[model samples]
Target chain A: MSSGIRVASLDDIPEGEGIAIDKSVTGTADDIALLRDEDGSVWALDDTCTHEDASLADGWVEGGYVECPLHSSKFCLKSGEVQNLPATKNACPHRVEVRDGEVYLFPNEAP
Target chain B: MSSIIEPATGSGAGPSASGGERPVGAATAAPRGALRRPVEMNRNIDVSGLVDAEGGLLDRSVFTDEQVYRQELRRVFAPSWLFLAHTDQFHKPGDFFTTYMGEDPVIVTMDRNRRIRAYLNSCRHRGARVCRADSGATRNFTCTYHGWSFDLEGKLVSVPNKGGYPESFDTKDWGLVEVPHVESYRGLIFGTWNPEPVALREYLGDMAWYMDAMLDHDDEGTVVVGGVHKWVLEGNWKLAAEQFATDWYHVNMSHTSALTVLAPSGKPKAEIVHRTGRQYTDPNGHGAGFPVHPRNRFDAQTVHKWMDYDALRERLGEARVEGPLTNGHATVFPNFSYLPVNGSIRIWHPKGPDRMEVWAWTIVDASMPPEVREAQRLYNLRTFGPSGIFEQDDGENWSECQAIAHGFITNSVPLNYQMGLGSEREDGRHPGTTSELYSDAAGRGFYRHWRELMNTPAWHEENR
Candidate 1:
């Protein structure tokens, strides 16, 4: 239940979709992308599609899903579940928390 | 017996060989309908009794014969319940998807009544295909050829000139030849050729039990997340159908290269996974499964401990998925491979004896988180795509096996399946059919059933 290490300050970017690369998953400079939905909330998931290695960060966001550009398959950002076809699996999600004026992601892969 | 069956079967008797004379490579003892005999032997093949306790394996002719391919369209594919797109394809009323039942193009749609319907694509007028796209939603169809139109119910609602036909013309009979039966089990839709094929539920039998592990669990259970990747291949339709249905033996050799790459550069021995699968050939031409298992994985205690049915509160309401995922695959009669991989159902419909189109789709647990879905997709693509290590290797072998038949002598020769020939034992009370997972019984059983389907002139009586 420890708070995530501070990785970025609040004024660095607004809502919608944002990127921060300094987050470390076991010491690797894991580049994570923050997707802000219409509600101004944010969720972080692995930035790549498992099928063809397509970039998931730039994908179209709708109804809490990020769709891969190559095949148009959608994945749930929160749980990393692939909700659509062409893809049969899920993506990876991370822990994100806001403290003071900074946002940090605790990278974990237990799911 | 060996020398008499050879003949020029590559083209299955063209104009020259078609004159009803002895065909090239044809055995002297071969009767008019007999062209399946192999031509040579020695480290290759020995043609003798291609037809066995199960049935007959095709000579090179089955692959190249146009007449044979046409006959199969009716005898094998037509009468069999060909798998079509799942119910997910028809998202709502008026939604539709087209698939081939052998050579016959089919149209499956969700009507206004919310019921699913299927029909031949041919127009009621000149027999031209009525629907042209892969899939769509529409209230009615207007044939571009002669302006013949029909509604979602498949009833001919209009014709450009009503009087174009004679007074005796009956529109009811002309309605798109509605597939007599369309049934969906756990979101998978299938159509049959006979006025009645065995109750699909019954045909499915214990397969449903296995399928439940892959599909039919949880809410929103499975959805068509994307479309199919179709490709043409040169091989008997049965090869593809049988490969998925129950051909686990090929993995040892056909996939040797890919498996080598996936594993730590090795060391001499092949220890990828020790397998034990058996084969069970039914009375009709159906029933094939890997019968292969990565030995000793599904333990009784494990099922009791992990997936306790007391949990069947969700989807099977938690009772299922509690069991370990064992067994490789369970293929239904004619077509449809209910696979254990990526939780997908593959329908390898026959185009001709030697040509086919592959349609694959993924089924995921609806309640699963998106991250899990994404991971599964990645694994599925790496393993099953056209270029996937597994599928790519399979494609090469299936085609090469077909290509080897072109040689006059090689084409007529027979391949040995004599392994475990006399050691096979049949058990009656297993609740399921069983064969040696490590032997050639699967292939032998497959060929046996193929012969029965091909030779049987009558559907109800014992196959000839």
Candidate 2:
């Protein structure tokens, strides 16, 4: 059951940056990170890194990759593939959309 | 790999360029200012033994065990925040100072953009130390071995005989390994290798309030005198730190002779009075024993000229001046300690389980007059310098205790730490855990924190 849920508005996330949405949101139980790529495309991934529990939202984002702050492992948002050492497993990617200035997230099942 | 600076000098074809030359590399020796290389245990380490803090019992072997010391280098020193250098030391770009975090040599320098950075002193190639000078301005550090060079920012800039390596060699992956975290409080800089350790502010906790009295009293702040007085002690580093933390009890016995000479009457005082002061031990293991001189103690006795109570009163007001500016001793957990009385600040560098190097500095308010600064320096030399009367007395006791730990029968028994146990209570006058001036609250708390850190592996697989 993949239902579209509005998570935030465009104003909540600036361009070329990412923000973490977790328990702060009333309906969201698990962590879901929403990122706005440099190309203005919105992407979502499981907030926690597979290698370590560090939040991907806290990781540095450049272009399509988010580098883990813990060990500098770069993970690609599109393919969910880790691009650096110390992190061998990929993050789970989810479907994201922007409609009428509202951001919607379809959470992906954890691997 | 051999780029000779002053060729051969007086040797037979010293280190031929074709390699296969000197069996030992030219850079085998440590750099000019490097401390003695640390000694490590050849056998496996076991840290299963514990210190029962609440029970007031500590295993004697914790101070003398070789394996436990090895574990401490990684578990306690590497992960926790350790004082590296002071910001005042770096007046301009390229200025740097070489220091030790545990036994690991590190260089703290200011880059061209004036950003301070800390790097492992070891070279990326062959592990020879990169920086040699103790303190100076430098453009780059060229490894005496293999002729590899690193820029001020610790980036590998040039490598001699580059064509000898494979075509895929990448310099990006070979820069000097940097200490991952660097932060400063007031002017003191600290670095940590642990990626997920607590924030520096939180690590300091309430200790910052007491430190502010010394470092941040005046608007200009405190400045460390130019040179450092360094010496080696044949004792575990913790003994010195713990003493400074919560052992005011030793002052009477340890310096009884010196007191008789310095006091107006040439007699050992019947009883020492510390009614003006209180002791505090933070949960983070930081501890301080500060004397609150009644505003009128300035009139009854002579305070150090550098202490300038009148100036303090004007700047910080009477309440703070009485609370923090008075004579006191404090330890910022693990090793960094300072005495507000004589302006002696030091780091007890753990050389091994049974040895430590004490590097001390005399700090004064940067705004103080030249005469006051000189008096402060002289006072520090007389009281806390390597050969000072009080320092020697303390050293003798520590060395004797360490010697006893070497014996089989001596180290088998547990030592007592029960002074003021189960008697500590919260006091409104100060924050954190408070106890009487003469108590083992800080000592017991120190060991508890040590046990937790020693047991908590830095690289635990658990998330969060």
Candidate 3:
């Protein structure tokens, strides 16, 4: 049996944007960011940027990356890899599943 | 107003040196014992003996000593007026721009009353930065950590959990620390941390008279045209400041390639270098160097067409309009430098003994037409911006100076500033000490003032 928890539905997130799942609800060390690509594919990563105390859900999502609002450090949404300077550490990737239009977060599991 | 932030205890790092303090009630915060200990100020270095302005000699160790750099932050920067931002940057209440006062990050904002105020950017709670963006409009600066927030006047407005704090925890006692002295001359705003400082006009001295050529030429004043260009350079801050103040002589050789590219098709090097020019050195340490006559096609085509020479001459007198007001380079004491010809105004923000970060902007008369302003902006970007041709030429020389100055034997040798010693004269036409354009009088004046500040412990003593 999968230990995934339902977080949100597919229609809840706008295109090229993200929504944050609170740590209390996900039971993880950090908040999880649920991002929707322009093509409607959903990805999950740690919400806090590895470089600073910023919520990636509040960043600008374009293409396959999210740009940190604080310092403009871009990170790959799918793999959680940092793509710029001022941020050398990569954000942790989180597993996500979409079953019948409902979004399920796999707690701390890797994508 | 009550001062909320106490003076840093012991030898705690300045605002720019230290990261955010440990978060309250967090187990992940660094262990108390692991925190940095105060560094003992170096007593062995004789600050007074480092610069012999009369002899035109400067010790190289001044550029390499960590202790000297630390002391300079307190003595030179804390009391001196440093450029913060321009009035044009703030359009409405709560509009702000972030800048540095010698390495210490600060926020310059317009309060609800439209009064300009500046405060240290560090948060009052756990010391995280309150404002991270370069420029923005906001109602309250909410810290990313712990959700502490401050209003436009830097007043502590809210806390995360009101029930968790004891009754003794008062928000009024934890407001952001204000810079204390904020003033403006023309459109440029300047701030100082010292509670008591000389009046801005008195501190500007003769430099104000010289600056009027550019600042007061038009009735509408000036405004920064574009986004700031910033980059780090591996060089001591003084190297850039002093050069802008009094080293126009370097242009003939250091920027030969730039000259070759910029010079008109048939113009000879002799015509550029042999032109008569003047230099001015003020007791306040400000300096300027400019040609007596227009020397380039750019000035003739762009500057002359836009500037009202007749009105400026009538208003400012012929001595200013014809001389120091023309195309030139100048520095306002320690780090604020500008080039009137290129329309570039910059601050050489000291990062460390061996490094400096340059923040540059293009400024133009507000009354100028859009086309003239755009032309000046492009010209400034091509000549003095981060990737400008002349900037690259100058950066190489400055960085190399820092790279070699750290060598044991290299630092022991003193450098020369004796280009035009004793040649400084009081020309009846201009205020302050004047000399032929090639002199290093301004360099000597700069060191003399620097040494004075480094030796004096308090503003009252220095002024006395």
Q: Which candidate is the best by lDDT?
A: 3
Runs in model 2 with CA error above 4 Å? A1-111, B1-49, B268-276, B295-320, B460-464
**Candidate 1, CAPRI quality class derived from DockQ:** incorrect
Q: Looking at model 3 chain B, which ten-residue stretch has the lowest summed lDDT?
A: B1-10
TM-score of chain A of each: 0.74, 0.83, 0.93
DockQ of each: 0.01, 0.01, 0.04
TM-scores of the candidates are 0.63, 0.70, 0.74
**Model 2, global lDDT:** 0.73
Selected candidate, larger TM-score, 1 vs 2:
2
Report the lDDT tens digits of candidate 3 across residue range B1-464: 10111222211332211222322111112234466434343232458889999999999988889989987887898779898887888887778999999988898888776667787888866888899899987666778777677777676766655569988777765667776667778877787766666767788998998888778876778888989889999999999999999988988789888888877773446867776678999887889987776323235357567777777779988887778676678999889998877678899999999999999988888898888998888887887888888999999999999999989999999999998889899889888889888889899999999998887774422223
Cα deviation of B310 in candidate 2 (Å)? 5.9
Model 1 C-alpha lDDT per residue in residues A40-88, reported as the tens digit of each score: 5666777766655455665556568776644556888788888876668
Q: For residues B195-251, could you state the per-residue lDDT of candidate 2 as single tens digits?
A: 556778799998887787778767777788759888999999998999999888888
Q: Each candidate: what lDDT?
A: 0.58, 0.73, 0.79
Q: Please state the CAPRI-style docking class of candidate 3.
A: incorrect
Candidate RMSDs in order: 20.3, 19.9, 10.5
Candidates 1 and 3 compared by TM-score, better number: 3
